[model samples]
Target: METIQAIYDFLQTRTWLQVNDPEEQIVFLAAGEYNENYLITVEEIYGTARHVFRINHGSQLGLANQIEYEFAVLRALARSGVTPRPYYCEPDPGFDELGNGVLLMEYLPGRPLDYAKDWREAASIFAAVHAQPVDDRLIPQPDPVRDIARECEGLIGRYPDHPMTEARDRLLRYRERVLETADEFQTLTADDKPVMANTEVNSHNFLIDDETGRGWLVDWEKCVVTSRFQDLGHFLVPTTTLWKTDFEFGREGRRDFVAAYLELCRAKAGSGMDLETALRCTEIMERTILLRAISWCYMAHYEYTQDGRALRNEDTFARIEQYLDRMAWFFESKT
Candidate 1:
């Protein structure tokens, strides 16, 4: 209740709002990897409004000015209309008992994306975001292939107690392949232009409104300056699409999704990329993303196995197990 009281007191500072009862007005929303979200409902000058009070525990980008960086990106993408609008940001709110940083933003209305039905809608959201100007403040990942290799090495290295099972060896082999074809991967993205991209584009990261039919990608903790394909690939890869949902598409469906994104980008003012180039980029990006995802599953599986995670979801564990047990499918899809 201490956190609730602090939030109530904080809401009072928003001179433009009317919070009759903080306990009734503020509600716990969700706890993410780095922050706790509180849905704040207050009567604004015009009418009732909803905003998210995000308490940041840390930054995935490892920025000292994490809140500032995130808010900057939010503000930059506001014009794109696919992301939430930022109202205020306090990197240090002096919340010795609550959080390291705070962000107040417009609360969007929607539910976690349903991959089975909302694939094209999800593509539209990414297309709108990818159309936005790239923020120079973001850390650019120019070399995703090498980046995935290094990340795999770090995550897989920590599992010393784990045996070198076939799955582990295969994961390592993927890393070796990425490193070996490093030059080709570089060439694939050499002509690419940087865009505002969310590296984490899994199903849950996106929201689709049933009535209004609007789509949004709400989580930006992993946002970066990178090739648009990084996000598109993440969204399309089986590792992601099948993570939160069991939806899978053969080559035809994958082609159609990219085609939808291409058309949307063209509508957004004639994108510099065409269907063929985007398809090629998406293909290569998925290959490296597979390596990255398996490595992550290994790290997470070990953590969950050791009860290192503060919160564990049976669904997540089940999905990770499926990925490891049926590793052949993930590898075969790389081709």
Candidate 2:
């Protein structure tokens, strides 16, 4: 109740919202590990309006301007029509009610993407979202595969040292296989264009509009400057899809998705992305994204188990356990 009132109180501070004269509301939408979302509705002078009030826990990017950075990225991608338009940002910490920080953006109309129906829309969404130009504001990852492996090593370093010794050793062995094949595919494409990659592209992060059937990608908390291949590869990999869903695409379906992505990438004239070379870079990401996924589960599972995160999802913990149990199934070398 206090949190909701705080949101309304914050709105009252905003002259544009006119909280007193308007039929205003702030309802809790959802809460994730890093942030809590609320749907803000108001009857403004123009018309009924809605936006998401995203309250941050802290800096996931390890930068001072984390919220501002996300707002900026959203603003840049707003023109692309694939992301939400950022409305306001309160990056300064220690406000009356908004803890850490908060940002407001257009409340996108849609539901969590359904793999069976929304696959093609997802491909187009990723293509258009990645087509947006990249800049230095986002964290630059020149060698994404190596970077992923390094992060895995870090995440794994936490376990087997304690209660998860077996899981740790198991993940470590599979990670070695991932690391060995890391260099097999060319990391850098011919064009060498760095994309504004949404590192976390799970099905839940994507939304499909009911009426228009348009795709919308949300949750840019893990946004980075990396190869678009990394984004596409993560979306294709089972480790990602299996997180919130059990619907797995067959080999032919994957081939079709990649073809659509390639075609869509080529179609976006303003994206400045090279289709042929990017396809090559994407190939490298396929083999490496798993390593990151495994290590992430191991680390996050441990963290969530130990009450490391503020918001804990038992469903996520169960899936992490499943992934850890079958490390080979997810990451085994195909050759």
Top lDDT model:
1
Model 2: per-residue Cα lDDT over 309-328, one tens digit each: 66676777888789888877
lDDT of 1 by residue, 1-335 (tens): 67878877765775535678888888889876567888889776788889898887766566777777888889889998889999888777765535677888989998998876898898888888988888787778888778768878887887888764666788887788768756775787787677888888888778788999998888787788877888888888899888877787778888999999889888986656777877887887888788888887887788778855544667778888888887778878786
lDDT of 1: 0.80
For residue 284, model 1's alpha carbon misses the true position, in angstroms, by: 1.3
Q: Would you estimate the TM-scores of all the predictions? A: 0.89, 0.89
- Per-model lDDT: 0.80, 0.76
Q: In lDDT terms, how accurate is model 2?
A: 0.76
Mark the regions of model 1 whose C-alpha exceeds 4 Å error after superposition.
10-18, 159-167, 306-314
Q: Which ranges of candidate 2 are over 4 A from the true structure?
A: 20-24, 93-97, 159-161, 270-283, 333-335
Stretch of 10 with least lDDT, candidate 1:
307-316
